[model samples]
Target: MMKKTNYSYIGIAFIILVFGILFVPKIVDRISNNDITRKESRSDQKLKNKALKQSDLVFIENTNNGENRRVPAFSFVNQYGKQVTNKDYEGKVYVIEFFFTTCPTICPRMNNNLVQIQNTFEDFEDFGVASFTINPEYDTQEVLKNYASTYDITNPNWHLLTGDKAAIYKLANEGFYIYAAENSAIEGGFEHSGNFALIDKNGFIRSRKDAFGNPIIYYRGITSEEEGTDDNGEVEQISILKEDIKKLLNE
Candidate 1:
């Protein structure tokens, strides 16, 4: 009777071991699959957040051009006698401004404001500053070089560009969407917006602070009201611009 009872106990133990062998791996696999799904869900959420940050930036859109908007192709000569086109700034972040060296009204302040930004990011190689001359006739490369000296601009990263009026105007008005016209009444003999434009590395004009304020919500770019003043309104512009640049860089 003792030997029979011992055999019965061994039989029960063997059955329990066989059941664990059959079921344990499947249970572990199910747990591993759930963990993989959880990890994938977390990755997707991070990507979604990153995309939101990129799209939150202001975009200059032309419904006529469909949903995708970009800066038109352009070619010009920089102050250093180098041919500057969209290629020069490809894969890099940059700021573009429309101004002539002869302006006695707003260009001074614009230059000064730009100087501060330049100084701030002077060491950043992936960044650049390009100022286009509305009066290309007077702002030849040599002349631009001379004017740039006034603001102590010594870095080649800060390019002053000049080119044919028709191309420049098309780019300014249609590409960058800033107003550039021959106006005899304006102090500089030309009428152009003082708004500085921010361009992403992908050749898209990300933001324009101009008269239209096209979207009317973005405060990072120049505004019609802010451009008219001589005070520190641009201080706010500088702050926003810096923040936006850092935002883009991080992404």
Candidate 2:
């Protein structure tokens, strides 16, 4: 009887020992793996949130010919004779527009808008503005220089760029998503639409605006315009977009 009792006690102890050996490591491993997974999940969520917020941004639509579209890689030289590429404006709010120096209608208003923007952020050092002339052939460095002088655009942050006709057209169509084409025969040398493209710091198309909050054009570039521009059209012109830049700079 004593032997049997001892054996029974030993059996219970062995069972408990076996359970501790088998279950403890598994529990520890599960918990450790869960922690790692949760950390990764949080990191991934942050990236996703950034991307989604980028998508929510609104910018002037890219009018390819007449239809709205997204822009492609644009490269040009500013009045200062520096090669300006899409890569230069990363991590900053960039105001891009398609215009010629001699434009009688929309170009002047666009420049005025840019001038106001320069004044608004005269003290701001992070944001930037770039304007591309559709008539690159006539709007050469000298022509741009005269135009810049006329507007008193002294801000070092502003760039008036002129480059190869094909390159500029490509940039207008591809980089900035504007209606730009080479037509020396035309009175202006080239014909393109009037649109101001507002790009966020991440280099994604955020919102496109006309003179004011007018929804003359709107496209996000990643998705269809009809779909992408729907959610963002409610926000007033440059006001919300400008605030976004301020918030980003603050961050």
Candidate 3:
């Protein structure tokens, strides 16, 4: 009986030795080669890669000078009645829009899209929005403040700016090439493009190239992501704009 028990113990020890010698090193090697990751971890890694897998964004250039167009210098009072200038956005990636609080047509849709963007980047301190009211005469700091509240605009960097009418129009029409003018024929008594300009950290305007390889220059802002396409068949660019903003932020 004693001899038989000893044989059984020795056989078990031999099998354990074989396992350590034959399999342990391969397990260690798999770990070292990153081939032993969990399924969840692999999925997460794929998502990270996809998020970062975007083509380079292009700088919108001046037709006459062949130089990168930049956000021109301007100063205006924010919703909080604080002075804001281009200097305030020096190292930030921001969106610029011309809007008014009392606008009855496209402005609401444009701002709703912007507010969605604001929520998406709420955690990113360097992301912001500059809403220049085309009707600054009516959109005083108080009215702008009320509008901000109504829209639930919580990002401290987002400024609903209002100031000199002439300067604002110049910034819209000449500086950014987004039209903003008084038009009694328009429903809102003012007319402006429902487009948003994207600016990089260094203040240069940036955009993704179109299918034909030209800079799209402006992103459509009047359509919400949920709406997808409008009555005129204009597809919403907000989703792409958000992705491009992420690219600029990473840059």
Candidate 4:
């Protein structure tokens, strides 16, 4: 009986040793490879994406009235020679830029970035662009049309617009708060902001907040995604702009 009891204890000890040798290393290996934590992290990310909210973006406000700022009403002739107004862009997400076809620098880069953006959302009918030419006198219907063709502007909603110079300037300066003036001293014989304004489907200007939680009113358009940063060491915002555009579209 004593020998039988000792043999039973030895048998139980052997089984425990075999179990540790067979399974313990695999569990340790899984932990070392982060197999368990990785799945948990992916699940957490999915939950966060599902909870996306409209508050992720900021509504640019009118400093004077402290109300949400909106794109002012305006009328202009598009590259196709059709009249377009603020009402035309209702229920659409569009980017606004002040550029002329004859610009010697910056304009091309800006438009190239815009072209990339246009292609990114080619399937979305509500995505559009409004290129208001500061030099309306020179960028007539024909010139704007040719420029659009050269840049491969395929989006039907993209409108290279030109009209009364004063109205365009008013739209640029007072309406959008983007600087635009006839400056012969500049290389392009005109001066305008190289930033782009983002408008939501409701015609209200929208933008993402900065590091300090302040609305970054406009996106830098001069730097391309490939460039990442310009000669002046300014970081590119095109990627972030695209992300924000998606956020608004989903909203």
Could you say which candidate leads in TM-score? Answer: 4
In candidate 4, stretches whose alpha carbon ends up further than 4 angstroms from where it belongs are: 1-55
Candidate 2 stretches with Cα past 4 Å from truth are 1-55, 58-71, 174-177, 181-190, 208-251
Q: What C-alpha lDDT do the candidate models reach, one value each?
A: 0.76, 0.68, 0.93, 0.94
- Residues 39-83, candidate 3: write the lDDT tens digits: 668999988886676449998888899998999999999999899
Encode model 1's per-residue lDDT on 56-98: one tens digit a residue: 4666677686554666778899888999888888877878888
| True-structure RMSD, every candidate | 7.3, 9.1, 10.9, 12.9
lDDT of 4 by residue, 113-211 (tens): 999999999999999999999998899999999999999999999999999999999999999999999998879899988999999999999999899
User: How many backbone collisions does model 4 have?
Assistant: 0
Off by over 4 Å in 1: 1-55, 208-236
Sort all candidates by lDDT, best to worst: 4, 3, 1, 2
Per-residue error at 130 for model 2, in Å? 1.8
Best by lDDT: 4
Better of 2 and 3 by TM-score: 3
Per-residue lDDT tens digits for candidate 2, residues 1-251, read 99999999999999999999999998899778988789899999999977765543344444556443434566788887788877777767767777889876557755765676677778877788888887877888888988999998978767898988777777777665578775778675566775566666666555434567665443222222223232456432444445555654543
Candidate 2 local Cα displacement, residue 226, angstroms: 30
- TM-score for each prediction? 0.72, 0.61, 0.78, 0.79
Clashing pairs in 3: none
Global Cα lDDT for candidate 4? 0.94
